[model samples]
Target: MAFSEEFLSELRARADMESVASSYVTLKRRGRILTGLCPFHNEKTPSFTVYPETQSYYCFGCGNGGDVITFIKNIENLDYVEAVRLLAERVGLDVPQDSRYDAGLFERRRRMFEANRLAARYFFKALYSEAGQAGLAYYHERGLSDAIIRKFGLGFAPKGWENLRRYLNGEGFSDRELFEANLIRKSSRSDRESYYDAFSERVMFPILDLRGNVLAFSGRAITPDAQRKYVNTSDTLVYKKGENLFALNLARKSKAGSLILCEGNMDVVALHQAGFDNAVAGLGTALTEQQAALLSRYTSEVLLCYDNDEAGQKAIRRALSILEKTTLHVKVIRMQGGKDPDEIIKTHGPERFRALLQDAANDVEYRIMQARGAYDVSTSDGKTAFLTDACKVLADLQSPVELDVYASRLAEETGVEKAAILAQAGQLRKTVSRKRERDRLRDARAAAAPAQKAIDAVNPERAKRLRAARAEETLLASIMHNPDIFSQIKGEIEPDDFVTAFNARVFAAVGACMQQYGHFSLSMLEGDFTPAESSAVAAILAQIPNLADTLQECRDCIRVMREEKGKVGRGEACSLSDSDFLKLFKP
Candidate 1:
């Protein structure tokens, strides 16, 4: 249903920012604001501030800033409308039904979710029933407890084409919903509806989102002859492979600003059952940027607990690259004997695994270890080669402190002087910096050339004016950052008077916000424009110069232009001639 402005306003009023944020973060009063550890990124000091007066929250550490609806949307991984509906429901408000709302799509998605839920329940029942005796025995042999099985909703899919189909069909679910949910398929020859249970003769793990919704499932096969060891739910309308994490619902509640990232569902369950409740696993695929961003929302640090094999090391490296963009601190847990976290925990006990986590090394140290394993460093030539390759790896470190530390370690390992190592580091940094600068300039030139060419061909005079107007817009942005400037211009100027369309839009948005709320905020306008418009506004703000003195400068320029116009009207000889003016202003 299309929500009214009043409904949204009422929802915002009922959903107090402090109260809602306090549910996830421990807030301490600081004057009129509330200070807490940023739930979006890991930090020792609290940079996440909540302005209760304005009903908004922002993390200065990260760049995430928004109102209550945005908070719920980010924290709960819901879209804007869903966030609004959730908060409205929380406050006992009803959303008005309207024809604009696609009830059918909503119903279809809900039915798919329901189908997955029912399939999970049926699989769980089958795991313990007579039909699941072999699966139960397999779990028993693997040392998994009944409580653990129930905790993870572990289940068994019978080795038949129609087992799940029969159960879901008997429950009155339509074939279309089942097929769309990836729960069934049709036979090629006879057109018989066959249950395409993604999992069969395997132990199933139901993956739950942070909101306790069953989004997908992962299953591990038991038989040696199984074609694939693990089978996961394919992407559906409600479940995206890269967007959901296993057991995040429970892990986000961890008091420590750290989480254990495992390679599989079994690892997560094993850790959780062993009192490490802050364990989560990525989808049966490699860790993605979206998954890393999601992890950033819960904790500040992550311990990678992937397998101790070649592929596992590769995955850890891939994950490190993906996580490098996020604010989450990353460390890799190296398993000594076991191949994976579950096996290590089962063999050496959970305490040993936990102790290993405590001693886990950061990415640089882990990469050094990985390099040492790959190359021999005994002889002088070997040491020289190893250092050369390792320095390249160390250069990828984002923190200068980390780079320095690793450089020193590399010097020690290679018997090279610290000064020499530092020189190499400096050279690498310069090379990388120059490459980045060139790429940036290339992109900027590419973007500007098209617009510039269009302007040059169509209207050079207007283009020059537009560029000047852009300079003015930047000045306005700088002024807007200062509350005193708004007071100065409150009665004297209007945004509609701006010359360029881009500047006019930004000024209009800011002016409307100031009029309505008595103040202007950049975040209030995040969703009000398209991505391109936002980028244009950001570019203008970044390029504008002398913001504090912009008003006087703009007024002076206007006066000069008017004076020159008056001189031309008097038919006086200008700086050049009429032909010169024509050439300069010609479109």
Candidate 2:
């Protein structure tokens, strides 16, 4: 729904920014602002700042800032209208809909949600039916309790090829919609009339968005000798594989401060049921940067508890690399006797698992320990190689205190002198630093003008006339910094007097904001902007800090802009040849 500026402003006024943010983040008041470790990224320090005066939040670490609606849209992955409605509902205010609101996109999303919900119901019903004996026995063998199974909405996709396809189509979904939902696929044959279910003879795990809507599914093969063990829904209108985590809807609500990063859906289920309610997993895939980023928003730290096997260890290494790139503190848990979490909990019980979580190795320590197995340090050559590679890893540590401790540990492990190891690490850091500088220089040298063009991408000749563009930007900023100046100069300058479509649009938006709110705010104008446009507008406004000479500045900008516009008009009318230029210079 499109809301009027007045209504959105009212919603912003009513919604509690701190309370809403605290629902997901643990915030502590700092002076007039409430501060928290940014949920948008991993950080040891509190960089997610909430300004109560404006009722908005900004993360200094991630550069994510906006009002309450923008916060909900980002954190919950909802659309703008959905986010507005969420905040409206939270404050017990009805969302005022504007006639300009187009419900097509929202309608399509709702249809997909309905399809998935009905499909999940059918699958759940089938799981308890006679046809689901194989799936039922498989879960029974895995020792999954009926309560947890049903709670997680575990189900069985039947062995019959068309079971789901026929059922969903009969329930009023078109074949194209079913295909779009990724529930079924058209036949490989020339005749498109025949279609088959995407998953069969597998245990179904419904993947939900934060709002508890079934957006997709992950299916684990129940067939004893199946070629691939698991299959997941491809990207659909409602789901993006890399952007979601299984059980996060429930997990984010946990009072636990940290989350357990497991590998599979069953493992996540096992962890959650074992009194670790903060466990979440990627939907049948390795941890992705998107998922890692999403996790950073909900928890301050992540404990990676992948399986004990080599594959799990490799996954842990890959996940750590990605997670470390974020601001989150990372830890690792290597299962003592089981291949995965489900097995570990089954064999060792919840208490033992909790103990393992408590004693989980810090990521850096775990990396160094893992490095030990990659190289044998008994021989002199092997010792040198181990120290060199180990120091290389240690050099990436951001904290000097951490580097010192790890360097000493590396020296002790390889029987090398601590001084020598530190020296080697220092050299390695220098070498890495030089290489990065070279890479940056190379990129700079090879770079052309930005491929991302504005509405008006100007050539060199056109750029010369963009002197007015700067003037236009300054005029906009002057108005932005002080709104009363806008009315003073309203009759003096026309919108078309602004050169460059980018600036002209910004000027128009400012005019509209003034008319509606009787004032201007950069944040209020964010709705009508693309990220690129927003950045451009912000850059322009930031360049002029003082509005001390608004009247003079505005008059000067208007005068310069008119001169530039006159130049463009004259230049367009008369094209001078090179000979004409040479004749003019001849005395």
Candidate 3:
């Protein structure tokens, strides 16, 4: 439902833009604006600027400009009501129960979360039953304790197709809800039920959000030689495999100072059970940029503890490339005496695992070692090639001391001069800098294109009437930035005069906000517009002109819009000069 303006205004006051954004981004104050690396997209330089004075933000790199609610909606993948509710709870304000707002998707998502919660409970209860003996035995054989199983909400799916379906139905969830939650599947056979369980005879690992809500599950077969060893819940309304990591709910709270990135749920569980409470793994997919950004919010460092296999090494390298763009410090843990973290903990004990973590190699050291393996350094040609490859790795180091130390190490190992290695690394750094600058300029130009700014996905007419749309956008932006100008352009422009539907809606919303709140504010638009619409509105507001020609700009915009709207019907509007159009508008 739509919140009252008073409630939203209060919420906005309580949850300011700077405070809300600082939790996810490390923002630094520059005069009145706070700047930081945008969490929405990966970038080295800080283009995400938060204006505390106006309680808004805009990313110059990406065209994502919005208020605090918009920031939360985009960063957390939440809808308008969900984002508002999250912010409301933060400041201890209860969301109103008014039913004016269309909260269809939000209510559906709430039901989906509830269904997943109930399904997780049913699976957990089934794990202790006689039907789950094989699954329980598998966990025990893998050295997972009963307490750890309960801690992680580990469960089991019985060896039938309709077990979870029947259970959820008994819990008042319909077949459709269960299916939408990805807990059951549609049946094909004539004699079977309409829907059957999605997972069968497998050990269920509940994947939860950071708030401890069960979003989905990953199931592993109990048998050792099963054809399909693992099955994960497909992407649904509440869960996305690539966007979420398993066990982050508990890992984010660890005082361990760093997160242990594991290869699988079992490995994360094993580490957590062995007193490493900060272990987390991806949800049956490779580490993604979203997952890496999520990790950076909770910890300053990430230790890559992949298995000691070729596949694990490759995953670690891929993860390194993803995390390189973030500010998080990275290190790679080399598993010894076993294939994976679980096997190593079982074979060498937690103490040995601790030693392995302590002896973890920094990313640069690991890369250098990896490069050394590709060459025979004993030969002169091999030494030169290895040095060349090592210099590339060293060039990425940000610390001068680290560069010097690594350069010295490379010289000692390859019989090359330290100065020569440093010189090569410096040259590589210059080349990288130039390439990065070029890419940044290209991205900036693309973002600043007038076509991009004027085009609206919801209103295709904006492209057909590009000139009018541009003028309408400028007028709306000006009125929002300076509400006093609303009086000057009061009778000259109306929402109906706008050439595009989307911009018309925006004009009406801006007028309504100004009338109701005595100011142009984003809080009133939270539930009134969709998230995309809200983002587009914020982009418009970010175009506040520097020159104080509000009256002239508004008149010109109204004249253009009038002529354009008239031209849609009559050919006489094409013959009207600027002065004649101005006479008609009378701004």
Query: Of 2 and 3, which scores higher on TM-score?
Result: 3
Model 1 Cα lDDT, one tens digit per residue, 2-68: 4555566677778888999988787999886788767765454576788775566766544455668
Cα-lDDT of candidate 1: 0.72
- Candidate 1, residue 474: CA error in Å? 12
The global C-alpha lDDT for each of the candidates, from Candidate 1 onward, is 0.72, 0.77, 0.84
Better of 1 and 3 by lDDT: 3
Model 3 C-alpha lDDT per residue in residues 1-587, reported as the tens digit of each score? 27777888888899988999998899998886788987866666787888876788887666677888878877887767888899999999988885654448788788889888988898888899999888888899999999999999999998988888887788888888888888998888867668778999899999988777789999999877767989999999878898888899998889999999998999999999999999999887889988887887788899999988789989999999999888888999988889998988899999999999999999899999999988998888888888889999987777899999999988887778889999999999998778878987887786565225533655688779988888888888778777888867877778889988999998898888777787767656765777567667777776644323659868888899998998874765677888986788775
What alpha-carbon RMSD in Å does predicted model 1 have with respect to the real structure? Answer: 8.2
Give candidate 2 regions above 4 Å deviation: 15-71, 97-103, 225-227, 398-400, 432-466, 480-482, 516-549, 576-587
> How far off is residue 157 in model 2, in Å?
1.2
The candidate, 2 or 3, that scores higher on lDDT is 3
Per-candidate alpha-carbon RMSD to the true structure: 8.2, 5.5, 4.3
Best by lDDT: 3
Instruction: List the candidate 1 regions with Cα displacement exceeding 4 Å.
Output: 16-81, 91-102, 190-196, 393-414, 432-587
